[model samples]
Target: MIKRLCFWLRADRLGPDIPITHLMLYFPALMRMICSKRFNGFGEGSEFRPGAYADNCSSITIGKNVAVRPGTMLFAEKGDGVPGRIIIEDDVLLGPGIHFYCPNHSYKDASRPIPEQGYFYKGDIVVRRGAWIGAKSVILSGVEIGEHAVVGAGSIVTKSVEPFTVVAGNPARLIKRLR
Candidate 1:
């Protein structure tokens, strides 16, 4: 029954979608326990709020004191005997509805439908220490948010951001340098 036990601890699919009832005051604590079991590394003092979704938890790691807000989705690629594909460093702030996608679907062939093109894997998506990602940001494959950087709300990050900088917009343009 080891497989069943693991599934119960993770609830990988259904757990994230379960809404917390008003009477369930310890819901976050329960989530923390579940994440610690599912994730590669669930850091000390970190919070993984309810409604945060992640599949293939073995490929994701969270550092100390990180906050993954509600509605955040961590879509990491499957572990091919490697891990840390989606790493969130210590002291990072992730806003609500943040989406971290590590796999990109192939669309190079115009002759075929996008779904028929299949999927491709990219490099890691890392959020360095002290970075603040605003609400509804979409961080795509192979992108890294540098230390102390700030991503504004509703931004679509397709590239790596520099340290101590501010980025926003569809492709996440440079707003200014903080350092």
Candidate 2:
């Protein structure tokens, strides 16, 4: 009941979409209250900037001191009585326009449209402690971003990144290894 009320309050002002929906996050107190009430776990000192949104918040867990900038979206799928999960560890830095997708569409049937084929839950997405995700980066399902690793802006991560490494570009190839 409380969750529904919070959703209604957010939906009334945010309209259940990205970009515009993120505007409500500008109010720190309101955003904190809403997130605390909605998500499965929301740690202290985490900031959700304006223009950020999360789907299925109850399945998501956010750690302390994580900063999610504006225009970022975190989506977790709940399918077949199983809930998808996303875990953002402590001290993570997320830039603007970043997107995390914890589910993908099934396209096994050639004749049917992708959307009509239903969806697949790929598993949880874990952003390790102190990792930095650049602006506009897309982190796909089942991908674990290693601790202290850096994902370049506009990159598309399809696999788990190595710890203390820098990756960039589509498919997110490793660029440099940090000490």
lDDT of 1 by residue, 1-179 (tens): 77765655555432344443111237767656666777888899898766677767777899999877778888887334333279999999888999988887889999999888777767899999999999999999889899999999999999999999999999899999997
TM-score of each: 0.85, 0.85
Q: Which regions of candidate 1 fall more than 4 Å away from where they truly are?
A: 1-6, 10-29, 78-84
Overall lDDT per candidate, in order of appearance: 0.80, 0.81
State the lDDT of candidate 2 residue by residue for 6-79, as single tens digits: 65665412224533345555677776786787677778998766667777778888999987776788887645
> Least accurate stretch of 10 residues (summed lDDT) in model 2?
12-21
Evaluate residue 49 in candidate 1 and report its C-alpha lDDT on the 0 to 100 scale. Answer: 67
Index of the highest-lDDT prediction:
2
